[model samples]
Target: MPLVAPTTIQKVSGESQVEVPDLLAVEEPLEIRLGFGPTSNRQQKSVSVTMRTPGNDEELAMGFLFTEGIIHQPADIVSCRHCVQDAQKEGNVLRVELHPDVIVDWSRLERNTFTSSSCGLCGKATIEAVRALTPGPLASEFAVDAAILHSLAERVREAQLAFAYTGGIHAAALFDANGKLVLVREDIGRHNALDKLIGAAFWQNWLPMGQFGVFLSGRIGMELVQKSWMAGVPLLAAVGAPSSLAVQMAQEAQMTLAGFVRNERFNLYSEPARVRLAQMV
Candidate 1:
């Protein structure tokens, strides 16, 4: 699917008026569904309707299922496909079939499903609600030099094919402990972008990402910290600042959080020990 759509608009400078064409990042709604049980008595249900940039939706839905605590492991999913008769609605809906033996948590699906591009998590009621979702402490002793950390933004930017075209998408990338780029995913929503990255790792059976670090294109939010923590990603760096709650959560999870990673400098908001300075022999 094309990531950019052209739209015509009028430009005004003082009293002067000019018509021009503008490129917009395509935004569309995706409905995620769940299917379970035997062939004879299967149950299909609606899960969520999220606004996304219209690509890598299977990974998006799977990522949503994992970060939201809906599915525990990849084995819980039997199959995933876009299920719509009309071509117009094909990419808008994705149905994930679960293993017959996997239990479906119906109550978890009763919340609001309309996710805007600005925020993906809808019902985080309180700080406790977020704290309750925290995963165990990360097991990796991964450390990177401050000099290397500041360069992550450029390395991630170099790999963003979609952002280079639209100039309006958020990106999440995974880097190895040595600062090598592993993979990247982009979306109009920050959370969705991270989800797509995580979902790809899950599809490839790369869970418990103890050997990986995350680099986000936007600010560090609590949910982003939470999601990466759940996946056991030990270090997260971003080009923007970290929220108070995000810093707190990262500290609690024993994960390193860095922000303002640009111009050869970065602010370590949590677990500063993970960012090492080069030692002289």
Candidate 2:
């Protein structure tokens, strides 16, 4: 199905009234389900029902599981497929089959399809209660030029085919250490976009994404930082402000966070060392 829909809106600025065709990003509900045990004895359970833009559905599901701390390794997923229902309903449900040995920690989960600030525990208490679910302090040696960081927003913008048409959608992209964009995903939901990007990596056996940087087309929030950190991304840059908790989470995870990346100016919130500025030789 097409990711956008056509709508007519009346333009009434002064005395003139004209109907104009406009494009709107399609938002729909996606049900994510989990199946465990051997194929002969598996049981399926509904996990999340998220409203998102359709495209890269499989990648979005995988990324959601990984970022939510539900699945740690690519090998943990035996296979993923859309539900067996009809076309209209088929694309709306995603089922991920897990290996028999992988035990899903249902009690420790604090999963969501949106939002990025709190991981069940909020503020200082988050450090104690939820940090165990995330990866340890990053040891990635990936670094990029500050100039490169400053230009990342445009790089992401040029590749945003969906945002270009709908303007109402959000985007998340993965860039290699050389400042080249490697993967891009767009959705009406910001977190969904991030999930699709990481999920693509998961399907391609590209976990431990410390070698790549993530760029967002919108504001940096606690959840985006948390998801990127969980995916092992060493650096994250966004076009808007980062929440206090997002900055705190990034610093605590030893990940570099940059915000307001546009017009040749950007702010570094944590792990500034990863952004190298050239020195006069």
Candidate 3:
């Protein structure tokens, strides 16, 4: 499946309208199926169905599983592949095989399985639910200069190839303490983008990403904070404002949360100590 599709649209400007060719970010539904249980008694069930761009299905699946507390590490996954039961469902269905030793709590998944790419983990009722899966407060001394943090948004913008073409994609990027771009993932859904980024790191066995920072191309929501915290990322910066719950969660986790990061300025909502400023404001 192509990440972008060509379409003809009406270009209107001050009563002037013309049909022109344009590019659009592709969005498709990806059904994530889990195959777990003892080898003698294997079980397969559709865990989630999210509308997302077609690329990075495996990463998205793995990341989703990890964030949702289904699988802890990459080793827990035996394999992730497209399950093409029918030609029509070739790229839309993905089956993840977990090690037989991996114990699955199906009841938990059933309660959160129906998710959209836009709204992640929709049925989550309380912050404590997330806290149960998240680790303790981040105690790492990892910090970055304020000036370096200011440049992270531009770095993500430069690397957002899909956003450049469609102007409708969201991005999540991982950066080192020096503000160097490590990797980026783009999707129509912001949550999916972050999942893809986390999944990539998970595949590399980079769980508990305490040494790096995560940058979002949009507002920081509670779910985003939860995902970052699950990955053990200490710092999360975003181009837009954050929700009240997001700040609360970040503060509780001792994670640095920066929002509205642009124009040489940003708001540090929590763990300000992790960001060094030349002169305190």
Candidate 4:
């Protein structure tokens, strides 16, 4: 499906209104189904359904599964594709076939998928529920200069093709220590964008992204931090602010968390040592 759609809207400027053609970031529900169990007794189940801009869906499913602790490595997936059994479900339903050896504990996955893209961790009983799935504190020596961090926001903006048209999409970008962009993904949902980026990295064998920093175009939340932590990304920066719980989570995981990463300034919430600041003359 297309990432953006065309619509007509009234352009109100000063005192006059004129109808003009415009584009909007498309939003649609994507159902992610899981195929697991032994060869002799295969089973399929719908794991999650998230509203997102339609693109890079396979990567989104892969990223969601990995971050949700369903699969560990790229080898865990046999195949991931859109489900077409029902023509009506085409492009909106994805099925991920996992290696038979990959055991899935369904109990841990008991939650509604209807609101996952918005209310992350809504049904969860405790924060530890997700913290347990995430890897331990990051220990990599990866670091970036404050100046380089400041430049990332503009780089991300320049690469956001969909946002340029709709101005409603979010993005997740991965950059090397020198501030070079490695990958970028955009979606109507912030978490979905991160999932797509991580999904691409997971398939490309870029897990344990210790040498790279991930930047978000929106505010940092606890769920976003958890997802980045699951990918082993040491540094997480955002153009917006970080939630109190997100900062605490990053601190506990020993990850470097920075927010308000624009205008040559940013606030470091955790692991400040990883972001080198210039000394006074």
Report clash pairs, candidate 2.
Answer: 116-222, 116-223
Q: Which rank order by lDDT, best down to worst? A: 3, 4, 2, 1
Compared with the true structure, what per-residue lDDT tens digits does model 3 show for residues 1-281?
A: 99999999999999999999999999999999989999999999898899999999999999999988888988899999998777988899999999999999766565543232232443234455667788888887889999998888887899999999999999999999888899999999999999999999999999899999999999988889889988999999999999877887788889999999999999999999999989958
TM-score of each: 0.87, 0.92, 0.93, 0.93
lDDT of 1 at 25: 87
Q: After superposing candidate 4 on the true structure, give the runs of residues whose Cα lies further than 4 Å from its correct spot.
A: 111-127
lDDT of 4 by residue, 1-281 (tens): 99999999999999999999999999999999999999999999998989999999999999988887788899999999998898887899999999999999776566312222323464233345556776678999999889999899988999999999999999999999898999999999999999999999999998989999999999998789888988999999999998767876788789999999999889998999999888989
lDDT of 1 at 207: 83
Candidate 3 segments whose C-alpha is farther than 4 A from its true place: 110-125, 279-281
Assess the local accuracy of residue 97 in candidate 4 as a C-alpha lDDT between 0 and 100. Answer: 94
TM-score of 4: 0.93
Evaluated at residue 64, the lDDT of candidate 4 is: 89
List, residue by residue over 161-201, the lDDT tens digit for candidate 2. Answer: 87888899998989987889899999999989999999999
Over 165-258, each residue of candidate 1 has an lDDT whose tens digit, in order, gives 7789999999886888999999999999999999999888888788888999999877788789767788999999987768767887889999
Clashes of 4: 0
Runs in model 2 with CA error above 4 Å?
86-88, 111-121
Residue pairs of candidate 3 with colliding backbone atoms: none
